[model samples]
Target: MDKKATVQKSGMILPRDLSERSWERIGSSLRELTNSSAWWLADWLIFGEATYGWRRYREAIERTGLDYQTLRNYAWVARRFEHHRRRDSLSFAHHAEVTRLSPPEQDYWLRKAEQQKWSRNELRKAVRASLAEQTRELSPSQSNGDEKQEVTQLSESAGADKRRKVARLTIELSPGQLDYYSKVAAAHGLSVDKWVTQVLDAAERRTA
Candidate 1:
């Protein structure tokens, strides 16, 4: 090894490797990357060198007749470093908060929270194990809002022979419309009626 050749670690830059021309290019690349909110330059620098090192190791192994598995392991390590670096850039926790739920449920929570602007505490409360106790008796559709749902229970028609009557309304939907409804409903795990209500509610809120 040349005494002047600096040891490069995975995902890091060494001052000794900078030629005047390379230093100027790096400075230019950094400025462009920073302006575009591409903050993974540090990660790229580290991974890029690791990849070069892996190629060198493989060549040396072949020349010296060393174990193929050892070189393979080195390649795997380099790939893993790249994977972790990209994932870390996404700012996700090591263990997701809602890991027990289905993937769609997890996506729903993430998107819904972002759309509704929920605070961390509010998000935790909304998805708490005992959510029913804290939440109002509304369908999943109605619970889409960030605000607390209001309950307006009326006294059972006091002394007027308390009776509850149910009303049913039916409408015909075209095959294409029905398909669209099913697709939307399946995405949210809601009934078609619930999905329609949610769409209308969101529209109303946006207009308001």
Candidate 2:
């Protein structure tokens, strides 16, 4: 008797086999549901948490191993753009990227993302560029004057072109510190290079 043939003919499902089959079915269902329902669920939970308070919400989030920041961003998007049906086109990360913007700006960026099919990183760069443009427009004087002069002088040497050559620096950091630094860079809409440059520039200003 062929053991494989016997097992198949008997229609026997072993415990491990049953578990695997069940998980496959459940996993497929979850993937389908998550595409649409996750953000909605997050928004609902956030509302419930706010109405009842953090302790209740905190327990629920901890039990699920979900990030609180993720839920908070979902809730913000839900509330801030409740009327916009197009929001479903983007992922939670995409929407979260624009949560810092005013409603109009959020809608603008979301539309841009949908039309361009931008990846999260691309969207991040666009958002940062938009923010930097706005900052420059709002504070022209800050971008000019003594601060600009000091930065130009510090970054360049005598007889060099107006454009300074990029400098390279290396540093070691623990995984946790590196993660934190990346988060800070993302928040400022800057690359690691730009963020580090700004930090050094700020330090120089303070000293001078």
Candidate 3:
């Protein structure tokens, strides 16, 4: 970006001969912003709803440029997970995966995802598998039918799983750094890799 681009409010302009390094950095920041936007919008909607009642929906739609249903869905997920219960290691989509589950169940799966570093689709599969087991254990009756329907809805809510390409990131660490990360990860019952990723994610969100 040029110096003029930094001060420009209308849009960001790239330099004619921008370095690949600079473009990569820009893309990385954009990805972080996209990921953090879910939590940020959800939290904002929750606060607005609490303070302004039903009228908040209209205000939110106008201010955020997000549809009413999307805003509503965000609020529902945010309401399901209290601030303390959210998994910093996981994306907001990960929490949405277990929104219909009981609080303890949500915590259980989130902890597993954090420890295993599962992607959103992986977490969805694990949750559906468990729910299927429960359905299988039940007798064929109205209640069992209802449970099956609920499971279907949960599956549908995740939308299409296009299975986008994933890029693996590797970081080198000193022995002392490894030990420190391990201890902190253990304190939070997460793997060292997960802990490191979570810390990095939090830092990104703070700046975003």
- Best lDDT among the predictions, by candidate number: 3
TM-score between model 3 and native: 0.55
User: What is the C-alpha local distance difference test score of each model?
Assistant: 0.46, 0.61, 0.68
The collision pairs in model 2 are none
**Each prediction's TM-score versus the true structure:** 0.26, 0.44, 0.55
Highest-scoring model, TM-score: 3
Q: Report how far residue 179 has shifted in candidate 2, in Å.
A: 36
Q: Taking the tens digit of each residue's C-alpha lDDT, what string does model 3 give over 1-208?
A: 5322242667678777777777787887766677678878888888777788878667767876778788779889989988888866688899999898656567777888998989999999988986676466333222233222211111111226755443334455554555565566656755454455667678877998
Instruction: Output candidate 2 Cα RMSD.
Output: 14.7
Candidate 1 residues 105-145, lDDT tens each? 44455455566666546556656733464244333322224
Better of 2 and 3 by lDDT: 3
How high is the lDDT of residue 17 in model 2? 36
Query: Which parts of model 1 have CA positions greater than 4 angstroms off?
Result: 1-95, 133-162, 165-208
User: Per-residue lDDT tens digits of candidate 2, residues 24-56?
Assistant: 766666565675575776667767787879898
Model 2 alpha-carbon drift over 4 Å, by segment: 1-37, 60-70, 73-77, 83-86, 140-208
